[model samples]
Target: MGKASLLTSERRNRSARGTQVRRERVRSAWLFLSPLLVGLLVVAGWPLLRTLWFSFTDANLTQLDQAQWIGVENYLYYQDGAFYGVLADPDWWNSVYNTLFFTVITVSLEVVVGVIVALILNANFKGRVWVRAAILIPWAIPTVVSAQMWLWMFNDQFGIINYLLMGVGIISEPLAWTASSSLSMWAVIIVDVWKATPFVALLVLAAMQMLPSDCYEAAKVDGIHPMRVFFRVTLPLITPALLVAIIFRVLDALRVFDLVYVLTSNSSSTMTMSVYARQQLVEFQDVGYGSAASTILFVVISLIAVVYLYLGRRQLGISS
Candidate 1:
């Protein structure tokens, strides 16, 4: 009886020590993370709060300092019989449609092509190292520079793209890649896919490289087909990495501004949410209206990210 009691006491003491150690570790972790938390609050949190504030006011570029609060007038109001503000604006809705379309198409294409490229790169082949290096060249180039280069290449009069298409009997005449409403969006998508596929491939390749080789060896010994092994074994293992790639790509595509702006230059057919906000803020000098649009964009992105992570986690059977 005495021995059992003593053992129980010792076990209790060890558990207490373990609890204390865990507490100390958590405290230390928070201490280390405080600086980064503070920096984010200063850099991102402050600007976001400021934008939210500006959204509720009648602030303009020239009179920003002397702005007046007007409630949610910039967002939506019904002073007249008809509705007004950003929510009711046709152009704003058009931009929203364009942004969503771009995000979906680009992300889907990038994932498919990136996975294929990653699979190819993962295979043992001659000049594998050089091929990997070359694949990343498009992603490494500056966005503005790449957009400008594509801009010139997309010229209908004298461009390599048109020349090739014409020479190959694809089109009888030189097609206007960027100028036409029908083809402008496709042009942007093509450029975006070309540039961003390497990023996704790199991510997926890293994930693939980390996978255990023993699985493949065992599958080979069992005489399992490569496709069957990949679907049943490899794809499931690499899904988490794919999720990460998809989320990152979605975020970038949703907030796409630079590439579209550079390629189309505020064209109605291809103008995204970011470009619409820019037009309001810079061109029209409607600070309050632009802030409202920017705030809506922030809310949309946050909701999408949250929902995506939730769905992804649920699919993976991971507990929050």
Candidate 2:
């Protein structure tokens, strides 16, 4: 009976120890997670909540303390005739059209040219290291510097571009690339494409380098065409990485400010949403209206990010 009683006591002690260990584990997990939760609340949550509140109120920079709870008055103003007039204005529409046009043309060309460049860089060639370094120089240059360089190149009177074109008999007179609204947008697109294509190439080239060589050897053994192998095997394998690169480029294009601001000086033909919001908020000092515009842009970009996340998860599952 004494032996049995001692066994029961031992079992009780083991159970108690297990429970204590579990409690300690739970406590440690919470301790580790606490800082991250606090950081998210402070950095992301607070700013978003504040922006939403400001969007609803008349929170101008000067009247921030005395700002009234207008309750969607700013949003209503955006829907009113004057706001609609701004929305419907030819110059506003032209800017929107130009922004979209530039994004599409530049991104499309970049992807195509970037892929070709990546393919060439993937091959074993003489001076390949130097070539890669040279390609990255354009992307490494500051946007402001790039803009100034392009501006100088596109100058009509003393520009190298005009001199070359005139010397080649392409045109008798110097052409002003930035003077006309129609040409100005394309000029900006060309400069953007030149500066960004290297980024796309590097990303794709990295993905290509990580691909397994055995698969390509198998394709060769099976007598598959090179183009067919690329489409069926290479593209499918690297799609997730390519999608990530494209999404980044898309977001960058949407928020484009520095290059456009420096190149065009917020001209009606080149004014992006960021330029417009900044002009109203900082330059014009219409804080309430500017906050509303910025809030909308934030929401739209957030939605795009959410969509990319969903698609990325779906692709991951498929790849797995």
Candidate 3:
């Protein structure tokens, strides 16, 4: 071969070898990951498939073995195509509305309150370490334990909340916080905000701490106001991390079960999507209907996540 032909053949051989090596590496990685993938398929995938199947059938806890497919009757248009199945169930709709409302209010409050708390904690102050640790106390508390604790605190007859309000002359009579429909949801929201805001704060504080000090120094040198520096510089840089934290809290709040269940058990006003599904499954023994609700909840959450991610991408100028 000529000099140019020899060099070209060598380059081709090298490229082929590189491609083979990459293929082998990818195969090895997949081989190592196969077990974990199989485990996930068994653990998560199987149950999801089972739930989907049950959602379309007449399954019951007692007669689970005798599941018989009855199409979408569990979900909609059951009686003469007039009475909606779970779709027309007022309690289910109420639970959905409660979930959406709780998600919006709690997440909004958490984000705003968390940003403030993070900013405070991020500053140089005496006992800053202790204060940061102390703020995490509420987040560390178990949700059920926190719910129960708040439940007692909200007791109208002898709760500390009532006592303080009465002492301050805010109200002459003790208000029923949990039992009253008007107050029950707010009471739950208060407890959730207390329990979760610290977590969001911690996340934001970590993000804030990682930010380059040069930005602050440059802004200071330019005579920029501290508030302007925050909104313009600090907020923009930490937007990604803050978005992730908000999304996590939103998903958690959407499917909330333990706090509402433990705090207000069966209260129509406080019933969330998760609690509603459980009530149908365990309490009413309507497994099929409950599974349908569970499926719908999953679809709703998935759609919300997709929309959120799409918006995030659009805002961040991501193509895919």
Candidate 4:
């Protein structure tokens, strides 16, 4: 009886100790997470709340402290014909169209070119490391610097681009690539594609390198054509990474300002939503209206993010 009682006590003590250890682990995890939680709430949460509050009030920069409660007046102003003319104005629509056109064309070209470049870079070649580094040069350069370089190249009379094209007889006369509204969007697109394609290539190349060599070997042994192998084996496997890269590029393109601003000086043809918002806020000194527009942009971007997440999950499930 005494031995049995001692055994029972020992078992109970061990179980209690195990529970205590688990409790300690939980407490430690929470302790470590507490600081991060606080920081996120302070940095991100507060600003978002403030922006939401500002969207509702007539908060001008000069009279920030005296911002009157305008309720939904600011939002209504954006909906009305006079104040919201920026939305439906022909110039505004032209900017919107140009922005969309640029985004679509540039992104499509970048994806195709980037994929090809990535494939070529993945192959074994002499001086491959040097070539890869050279490819990243444009992407590594600062956006402003890249814009300036391209701007100089697009200068009609003194530009190397025009000179080269003329030397090759591509054009009979010097063309104003940036001066003409019609050509400015394409010129900016060309510059953007040049600067951004390398980034996409690097990302896809990284994904390609991570793929299993054995899969390629198996495909080769099975007498699969290179094109078929790519579509059947390679594409499906690297799709997640590709999707991630595309999402990042899309977000970057949507918020584009500096390149367009520096290159085009907020030209009617090149002004994006962000550029428009900034112009209203700074140039026009219509803070209330700008805030409302910004709020709308935020909502649109949020919706896009949600759609991306949903689609990503679906794609992940299908791939799995």
Candidate 5:
């Protein structure tokens, strides 16, 4: 009886020691992470809260100090038997449509092309090192610089794009790629795909590299076709990486301003939500209205991100 009691006490003591060790580790982790948490609060949280606050007031760029609280007037105000503000504005809806269209198209194209490029890059070939380095050149270039370069290439007169198209008899003359409303969005999309595809490719390539090689070897010994192997074996393994890439690209594309603004300026055809917010904030000097738009944009992105992650988790069979 004494020996049994002693064993129970020892076990209890060991469990207490383990629990104390875990507590210390958790405390140390939080202590190390406190600086980063503080920085994020100061940098992002504060600004977001300020923006939300500003959205409820009648603020302007020049008279920000004298701004008055107006409640939801900037979002939707009822006056004189009518509705108004950013919510009722046709231009705002147009910008929302433009933003969604760009996000969907760009992300789809980037993912498809990126996966193809990643597959090619993963294969063993001569001069593979140089090819891998060269593929990243477009992504490495500054967005502003790339946008400006493409602007010139898209010029109606004496541009290389037109030159090559005419050379191939694709068009009779130089087309106004960035000037026409019909073509401006396409031009912006092209430049974005060129610049961003490399980033997705790199991510997918890294994921592919980490895959176990024995599966491929075993499939090869079984005389499986390459396409079949890719569909059945390779694709399922790399889906998580693809999901991450898509989420990142979707987030980035939704908030796109620089590429569109630089490429198409204030053209309504290519004006994203960010561009619309900038126009209201900077050009029109309506801080409250702009802040309202920005808040909506933030909410929309957050909701979409949440929905996407939830769907992704279900697809991956991850328990909540």
Candidate 6:
């Protein structure tokens, strides 16, 4: 063959090999991903799809087998030139408000207290090992167990919290911490912060340990205040891990059920979205409404995730 013909053949051969290599890589990726994809379908996707179907039907716990297609009757309605639905339900709105409030308070407290705890544990102090182990104790407790424990602590009579307050002359009467409308939500937030702050602290501590010491050393050389260094250097460096911790807490807080349910026993004041959904699904036997609530909860959580991810990326990209 001529020189040009030989060169063209070689180029085609190289292209063919490249295509084969890419095909093999794609096959390998699928080989590794197949198990996880199967697991997700079995564990999450199938149930979600079924729930979506139920949401659009007249499903109920009492007659689930005989459920009929009602077509969004549970989600929307029109009454004399007005629009109403779960979106218009005052109880649904209340639950949404309670859930968001609980999430915001607990996550904020956890992040702040977590940073302080992490900073303290990061220092070379006496009993640091024991303190670290103790910090994990609350987090290691089962959620139901922790909720029951807090319930006792917040009891109107014979509770440590009341005992302490009375001893300190803070209150003459033993207060009903979880029974009152105003205090019940705060009670839940406090319990959640107590239980979960350690996890955040430990995560942040791990991130802090991984941070380079050179930055701190340089900050010291410039005679910067410790507080200033934390904000200007440490926070920026730990943003990625902090974001992870925040996201973890946010997801958990948004779906909180056991703690509030166990502590307050479905009091409207502290009823969260998860609790409300369960009440409709299991107690009230309104499966259609319950599934709709669950679907809405999922959308709310997805929006939160997307917003945080977008903000984190935008902030990080700018800083970089």
Go through the candidates in order and give each one's C-alpha lDDT.
0.95, 0.82, 0.93, 0.82, 0.95, 0.92
lDDT per residue as tens, model 1, 1-320: 99999888878798888899899999999999999999999999998998999999999999898889999999999975989899999999999999999999999999999989999999999999999999989999988899999989999999899999999999999988999999999999999999999999999999999999999999999999999998998888889999999999999999999999999999999999999999999899999999999999999999999999999989888622
For model 3, how does the per-residue alpha-carbon lDDT over 1-320 read when each residue is reduced to its tens digit? 59999888868798888799899999999999999999999999999999999999989989999999999999986566578778989999999999999999999999999999999999899999999989989999999999989988999998999999999999999999999999999999999999999989988999999999998999999999999999999999889889989989999999999999998998999999999999999999989999999999999999999999989979877622
**How many pairs of residues in model 2 come into backbone collision?**
0
Candidate 5 residue lDDT tens string, 1-320: 99999888878789888899899999999999999999999999998998898899989999988888899999998899999999999999999999999999999999999999999999999999999999989999999999999988888997899999999999997899998999999999999999999999999999999999999999999999999999998998999999999999999999999999999999999999999999999999999999999999999999999999999989888622
Which residue segments of model 6 deviate by more than 4 Å?
Answer: 1-29, 80-84
Put down candidate 6 lDDT per residue, 141-249, tens digits, no spaces.
Answer: 9989998898898989979999999999999998899998999899999989999999999999999999999988998999999999999988888888899999999
Candidate 1: stretches off by over 4 Å: 1-35, 318-320
Angstrom error at residue 273, model 5: 0.4
What overall lDDT, based on C-alpha atoms, would model 4 receive against the true structure?
0.82
**Worst lDDT 10-window in candidate 3:** 76-85
How badly does each model clash, as a count of residue pairs?
A: 0, 0, 0, 0, 0, 0
When sorted by TM-score, best at the front, the candidate numbers are 3, 5, 6, 1, 4, 2
Report the C-alpha lDDT of model 4 over 48-123, residue by residue, as the tens digit. 7776777677778777677777776756545433553344445545656666677788888898899999999999
lDDT score at residue 109, model 6, on the 0-100 scale: 97
lDDT of 3: 0.93
Point out the higher-scoring one by TM-score: 2 or 5: 5
Runs of candidate 5 exceeding 4 Å displacement: 1-31, 318-320
Candidate 3 vs candidate 4, lDDT winner: 3
Q: Give the per-residue Cα lDDT of candidate 3 at 316.
A: 76
Clash list (residue pairs), candidate 2: none
Q: Which stretches of candidate 3 lie over 4 Å from their true place?
A: 1-25, 78-81, 318-320
Per-model TM-score, in order, reads 0.89, 0.82, 0.90, 0.86, 0.90, 0.89
